[model samples]
Target chain A: MAHLASFSFTSSPSNSASSLSPLLQSHQQPHLSSPLQDTLINIDNSATMTNSYKYSVLLPTYNERENLPVIVWLLTKTFQENNINYEIIVIDDNSPDGTLVVAEQLQKIYGEDRILLRPRAGKLGLGTAYVHGIQHATGDFIFIMDADMSHHPKFMPEMIRLQQAKNLDVVTGTRYAGNGGVYGWDLRRKVISRGANFLASVLLRPGVSDLTGSFRLYRKEVLSRLIESCISKGYVFQMEMMVRARQFNFTIGEVPITFVDRVFGDSKMGAMEIVSYAQGLWKLFVAV
Target chain B: MTRATEAATAIGILGTIYLALLFQWLPITLPPTIQEFILPVLPWWVLVTFGAYSLGNIGYHVMTFRDCPEAYDELQVQISQAQNDLRSKGIGL
Candidate 1:
């Protein structure tokens, strides 16, 4: 159970809770000014932008002390190797495992500008954690994935490459497509996941294959738009995001990804989350 | 799925029954045994159900046609970053 000083991002607030929180952040974290200005654009074939893009990786962690360091290291290594301009925004919900302390230590090693730690008071909803994290992001694109190692940072470069190649609004990873498959789940768990996804496909017909998949990269504005339109606050949020994105006529593409189960602690998903997902599916069928 | 269709289905089924009774579409000219056996029961239930289903489908389309779609609310944004900051430092609201 470790935590640290609450500092805002370059454009972050001194105290975010103030009812008068600014609508737009006008400042950049002073530390980031130089690097951001001289950012080198990777994937030269990308013709969408005049300048290099800044990536904000939003990592939401709870009791992931053991796996956090490795994930962050991998992410930084991946971005650095590819010469990609990136920032890691960790939104940690006070874990009893001192995950925050490990995050701060990584920040010191990697430098504060590259590793930003934004810690919350308690265990907020997963949806809200992402909400909290995205606000502090100052990047052209946003990446959301698990810190528990279920998702590998190695896939990020390829995801970005594909996104730039297609200029897609969203590029989600699918375990049910291409060469992707679940790595460590038993038969019953596999059946449940497959069944849930199958039901979603039949009901929502969201064009895309993996509706429940969480690993994804989104253009900043598109991600913000979908998040605002989305109503789900739990596991269903992922599915609704894909469904609503289609409803809004946004282009979505998929990349096959091997979804390995978490390597540490425990999985946050459970019976309650599954039940909520079924209810959410029904609501989506009726509404969308 | 709208209220209009629910009401229309009920109305259509009842309406068909009333129209059937008034028009007496069931042929009374048939054999006495046939008339007595099939007259009041079989055609009534099946046609009423079919009538309800058909009108309900039409009503669903009509309601959809007349309904205006609500615009997505664009103003809703993420919460301020201070939610994480203030609490982590132990100065929570």
Candidate 2:
């Protein structure tokens, strides 16, 4: 488990689970032994593994309580199968639906070292959530993905493999690429996403097929530099990151991914998001 | 080197050779700095390897996909188990 003092919890859990799991209840007791030594050597590499690069999954959650456990389990299974050293930094923005409680349960199951819960006051923007998560991540490669279960962990190994094989600075999951597509989205959403990507490509010339994809693996330093260079605050942040990466001359790779719509809870995207994306794209074209 | 890297390297070398030979005989307005500084530094293989890689990909898929089993079937099972586990706890679908 990572040192408790090492984390910076910006805000406390506003609400707790009304009923605790037996494991959590057991944990509530004074003290207990660790989970059967975990037997897995990769778990030992949670904090900056010595030999190989460790991947830090930055899962920014907001009202993702329902989707959290399934995603975490899927992540655990994926990483375990691939034998990758990793940690999950869940940067939650004070979700009211007991999301933090689910996250805490996840931390217990996976060990505190693997799951870092960094909560904040309220619903901050997506970019700031990433900024907060990066501050606490200890991995050499940082993974940014949604906690809403839209982006499955199945494609992660491919992303990592492509990143390694190509010596890539960035490997983003693209739904528009070969063998990649969106599932469960209506015609309107499909059109919007495609139109947005087309416009961004035409204007920015980033050479990346998908500019709005958030599921990406980044070299920690490259991401830090991009974050510093990027000025987009909200929906435009993902596109801005790609644009800045191109201007700064970073090589980005692509892994085709089937992006599924959220299985539970509502998608936060709406007309406002589209309008802001257009505005942000215009700003990026003019500035960058 | 892996197949992809080998492919990339072979294509890169071929493209470089082709460009050099073509430019030697053909009169093109290409800047000298491109041959000296930029082309050498750029990861042209990323673009150059596309022809071989995508062709291989298309051929392989077209020939094999009809008879090939679903490669990610096991992955689908694992995902179903995970979803069911969540469903048991009434957590997620």
Candidate 3:
């Protein structure tokens, strides 16, 4: 909202309402009738296009060589079609499957400015990966999501618009809210997810619909601070980030997203993770 | 002032009042019939109600959870498109 004008694609109509997808239009506010409304209003206010906000996507990869290229392509296509300024930071923890090799190939295709490869020596932690990615991030806003293709990049434009409209610190994609849903999850998986979400909601009451969702857009500074303060790892890390975000009184928004469970890789939700999730929830409950 | 302490404080205060009322330690005593029947079973009722609510909530969510077969289908299409595009870009997938 701070004079960061949305991109104006000349090829598309000035009042291109069709740019808003059905999923995005469902949550559309009056001012958001078209994605170009902001540009039209703020065109005269800003002289230079260089100052428009940039979004940096942090995609952490581990044994995702197959999915990496496709996800990056999706992200690139989404941003290009939307005309949104962005960069994708691939934080590969020395993937044994040569995810870094694919990332380098993507860098060559997308150019070094758009795709960044910040590889680590070994498998570290999720929280630290974001921290590392953030250090190299050149964008005003940061997006953290899976490289495993569960979270589609199509929702990112809406997420960005929501953030801009509301001037929110965090905009998380929720599969539990609105028309958001998960694909490929069976009854047992659904039950466990719903049950775990219910328990977390009852106990922590974080005021966010999806506490464990990794698909989120954060103001760069806000993300840096949240990462600095958060102390958990794995699924709980995502949960704690939201809980802590609320504790800091940061404004948050939600965009319904379709999570098509890992199309190429195995999705993990074992008993060990569940137990550790409970322990992490308890820790945040008492400590936060 | 964390969530845990806040919950504990509320429960402790409510529990103290419930105990006092149940034990007839309060200045005003409850009717014997009401005290003997309702008070003792009140906690059980709350527990059962809470458990039922939780189950219902979880069940409702599970049932209503949307299945996006279209998204899966779209992704399948996009994956092929990406591979083709990447291939055209001279990067082997």
Each model's C-alpha lDDT? 0.68, 0.71, 0.86
TM-scores of chain A in all candidate models: 0.81, 0.81, 0.85
**lDDT (tens digit, per residue) of candidate 1 on A1-288:** 011222232233323212111211212233443332222121122322333899999999888776777677678767876678999999999999888987887787778999999999999877788778888999999999978767767667667766765567898987776556665566557656766776677567789878988899999989888988888866688988998899888888787677767655667567887888899888777667
Worst 10 residues of 1 chain A by lDDT: A17-26
Residue-wise C-alpha lDDT for candidate 2, range A181-282, written one tens digit per residue: 665666556656666766676567789887888999999999989998888977689988988888788989888776766667777788888898888887
Measured by TM-score, how close is model 3 to the native structure?
A: 0.88
Looking at chain B only, the TM-scores across the models are 0.29, 0.28, 0.93
Docking level for model 3: high
Ranking by DockQ: 3, 2, 1
lDDT against true structure, model 1: 0.68
Fnat scores for every prediction: 0.00, 0.08, 0.91
DockQ of 2: 0.08
Q: What's the DockQ for every one of the candidates?
A: 0.03, 0.08, 0.82
> Candidate 3 residues A145-164, lDDT tens each?
99899999999877876676
For candidate 1, write residues B20-90 as lDDT tens digits: 65456755355666555665576577879977865564454333221111110110111123223333544
The top-ranked prediction according to lDDT is 3
After superposing candidate 3, which stretches have Cα over 4 Å from the reference? A1-51
